[model samples]
Target: MKASEVMADLRRRFPNEPEYLQAVEEVVTSIEDVYNEYPSFEAENLIERLCIPDRIFSFRVSWVDDKGKVHNNMGYRIQHNNAIGPYKGGIRFHASVNQSILKFLAFEQTFKNSLTTLPMGGGKGGSDFSPRGKSDMEIMRFCQAFIAELWRQIGPDTDVPAGDIGVGGREVGYMFGYYKKMAREFTGTFTGKGLDFGGSLIRPEATGYGNCYFLLNMLATRGIDIKGKKVAVSGSGNVATYTTRKLTELGAKVVSMSDSGGSIIKPEGFSEEQLDYIFELKNYYRGRISEVAEKYPDVQYLPGERPWKHVKCDIAMPSATQNELDGDDAQALLDNGVIAVSEGANMPSTPEAIKKFLAAKILYAPGKAANAGGVAVSGLEMAQNSQKLSWSAEEVDDKLKSIMKNIHEQCEKYGKEEGSDFINYVKGANVAGFMKVARAMMAQGVL
Candidate 1:
């Protein structure tokens, strides 16, 4: 199938859903040549089927707030594909959650999971329910109501949901508790559970830690040391905070971190002590990232602008939301002597930005390959729950590092140009993941 023709068809069908269309386009374009070699796939129209989700479950969540007021929110679970294994992905709870966004996420998750060499397929679910400013009781009520409708459709072997943007340990606890009550048997139907339960150790830091590990692997190919490298990172959430912490441990200066209100561009980089304060500020106080500037004399907070605007580092990690970095942002980064980018958030860069990064031949890594650490660890969580045992922090961390190295190797193997040393990791990751899923789908028949 022609990549342009397929994308045009998808665009016609999904006119206003730019996110979903962009995801499908990226994958097909990268692997178009490989896909063309499979005549049976073309005869069966596997590309089209792969682009569409297997099923989408939509429902409403009704909850009572602390003030005795009732609220309604829409919930969704897009079980995109399960050719490799059970449905697996995170459930987000933010005002921005929608079909297009979740569809893109699930599509990315499928390949991301495949790259992990785990027996897992891709899926994504979430609701447009902002957890911000909600009381604990209110959030608990909402979680319960959300799972009341979702529990019947999910199980350890059916569909496993984990935490995402607005859903964290607290939200997972509430949802898991409600699911246990509704389903009547306690099983590992969800991940990111509290350690008292079946949650895996190092799961919280898996994504960030894995991202840094992947970066090390990429840099190692060029014999570059990570120490003393100036970096810029976006987002103040689990991925960003832990990534910053890991980089600091490796002697890299992370110069920026941001949240909804704005970003903190610190030319001097953040000390480990400073990151600890940010952890409390965001995880406990639920305060804006602007608070970092307020607390620190050396930090600069740029309201209404992304950290990419002020980035002057060798590496940029857009760990925030989708499309947070655009073409202009990418150009600004390139002009500032940026040489590498590793996405911590799903689809953080737009098509235009990705084009510029590719055109400039920078060492770029997409979220699916670079940030699969969280889900890779989640896959480990699944295995531990199945074995009825837990691994030590060191064991889990070693396994995560190995998995990331393997992912980096796979990308290199598939992404290397015929004569050039530069590797197109996006193309490598997409092709590597697609070949696996496509073969799996072909073997499984038309389900």
Candidate 2:
């Protein structure tokens, strides 16, 4: 299979779905060489089959607000592939969600799940409903209405939806409650649940902690220690917050964090008390990251900006949304003496940014490998739900670390050149994940 031909065809077919097209192009470019080695896979048109989702469910969700006003939103669930196991992914409630974004996410999730060695197929569901500024009652009503139409298609053993971005613990709980009512059974239909429910311990911190663990492995390959290393982290959501927490615990100095409003730069690094305030501001008060600058005299807030080009650090982690970092940001980070970059958000770095990183020979770990921790823990949550048991925080954390280490090993195996010290983690992750799913698909036969 030629990468250019496949991408050209995809572009013609999905002319408006830029995000999905970009994702497919990246995976195909990485796995093209390895894919050609299997004649049967090419003969069966496996590449085309894998590029497209197994199914897509789109519907209108209408709910009444507290003011007696009705609002309508588009909801979607992209069930990409299930050759490995059940459909598993997150439910994002941001206004930015659409078929293109969700398709890209679901496609990335397929390979990400395969890297975990877990029995999970790729899927993603979300709506264009923004949870920001919405009252609790309004959000609850929306969640119920979302599941009211979607509940019939999902189950504990079928598709288990987790939380992402606008969908947090509160949103997951709301949806789980509605699903329980409709299904007449309390099962693990969703992850990122409240602790009182069937939620697994450390699930919230898994992604951030996992990214840090993966970064440590990357640093170790070059004989570097994380202690006292200056770092810049973007996004103040769950991933960034927990990544900051874990980095602090590892003795790294995190100098910056950001939100959609802007970035907060603390060259002296943030204290535990400051982080707590940030957590409260974003999670409870729904405030912006600029508040951090106002509260602390030492910190500087760059309104309407990201942290990538503003902060100087040894490591950079883009935990924000897709394409937040661009070629200019990549150059800025490289010029500022950044040695490594680990992604905490899906497709946060643009193609140009990724190209520059590869050219610079910096240790760059893509989102699929770096952010798989969140879904890995979600898979564990599924297992716990099936057994009617919850593991201790330490146990879950240990397993998460183990999974991250194994993922790193797989990347090295496929990404490292036979005689070179540099590892192309992007290519490695894509090829490794693709091989697994390709084999499974081949064994299962064409559907």
Candidate 3:
């Protein structure tokens, strides 16, 4: 369980996959006790098997833009593992897409999917094509072209992709349409679709709602309550919006919300009407957070800084992109008397930020565990599609809430350390996920 031992083993086993090695090292170092408890995990060569992905497919996507100019983008599908079931993850579309990030995400997905207790493995796919500022027709053409090459590699029973930061319901619809057209079959090959077609209710809100549910469990452990507590959240995307919605519903005063460009803080708390207007600006009009301050004279917009830097609150949720919060942000929260942080995005906090939170004994939930709700609901969507049934909004929301509670319990059960009030969620999540997949792999006996 020592850092040296973990690094040595990782380096020895995964010499070529630096991304996979870094992820494994981080999770393994946190849960070194698990390896100590089960020494055979290392002896039986499980680490070697688990460190490498089962398959990685790379292809070229050539599509035409609105200007009749063709562009080529690289796409990848990293099937991390399928010991439990078929691969499941989301497809991201952004200019920053790269093999290392995708592999890390896929590696994280393996454990995230396992934490849901669903029969899903781990996988991820995406292209470096940025959808921002593209016309609807241009985006559709890119999606169709991307899926034309992707369709041969994915299916309902094989690898099902959902939405991520850049890929939303629109991208899902476009991809699904292309898949259906090329394959000439109606199948639940993808999730996060329009509910009238094959999507499940509450899919859009699952990640945000589940994040609050997880934080609630963490608070319950210490007899804390979110009611009347001040909360600061980053990002105005689906996760942040729904997180704000649920937090406000639970009697928490959400004082701040931000997007990529800037952040806005309202001391009087954002009203439902104000939130509705902000939602319209961001979701409907694709506008920036700076516009919120102009529309609502009461709100204050802080330019070029994250909301976490200036807000004082009881709870802070980093719902923005990866590594959005760093050591300085963590220190600011700690200085402001923040108690808990639940990640709504993948690796939103840098390693230094997480270390600071852990050192301060604050409740910190890692993204892989906290943000698994999206994939969990996506898995449910796949189930409904396979069964040809759609669950009601309440039903789906209830299921999502239950799943979040279960995930929290699992983390608490495995992540608890003696003399530490702060739970080791990273360890809990990684080991719980690894145990499920390892047992499945053992049962199958080396495929």
Top model number, lDDT: 2
lDDT of 2 by residue, 1-447 (tens): 999999999999889999999899899999998999989998999999999999999999999999999999999999999989989999999989999999999999999999999999999999999998889999999999999999998998889999998999999999999999999999888989988989999999999999999999999999999999999999999999999999989999889999988899887788888888887887678898988889898889999989888878999999989999999999999999999999999999999999999999999999999999999999999999999998999999999999999999999999997778999999999999999999999999998
Quote model 2's TM-score.
0.99
Candidate 3 structure quality by residue, lDDT tens digits, 78-186: 9999888889999999998888778888988999999999999999989999998999998999999889888988888888988887889999999999999998988
Q: Candidate 1 vs candidate 2: which has greater lDDT? A: 2
Better of 2 and 3 by TM-score: 2
> lDDT of model 3 at residue 54?
89
lDDT of 1 by residue, 62-143 (tens): 9898888889999999999999999999999999898999999999999999999999889999999999999888899999
Q: Rate the local accuracy (lDDT) of all candidates.
A: 0.93, 0.94, 0.87
Output the lDDT of residue 320, model 1: 88
How high is the lDDT of residue 199 in model 1?
97
Candidate 2 residue pairs in backbone clash: none
What TM-score fits each model? 0.99, 0.99, 0.95
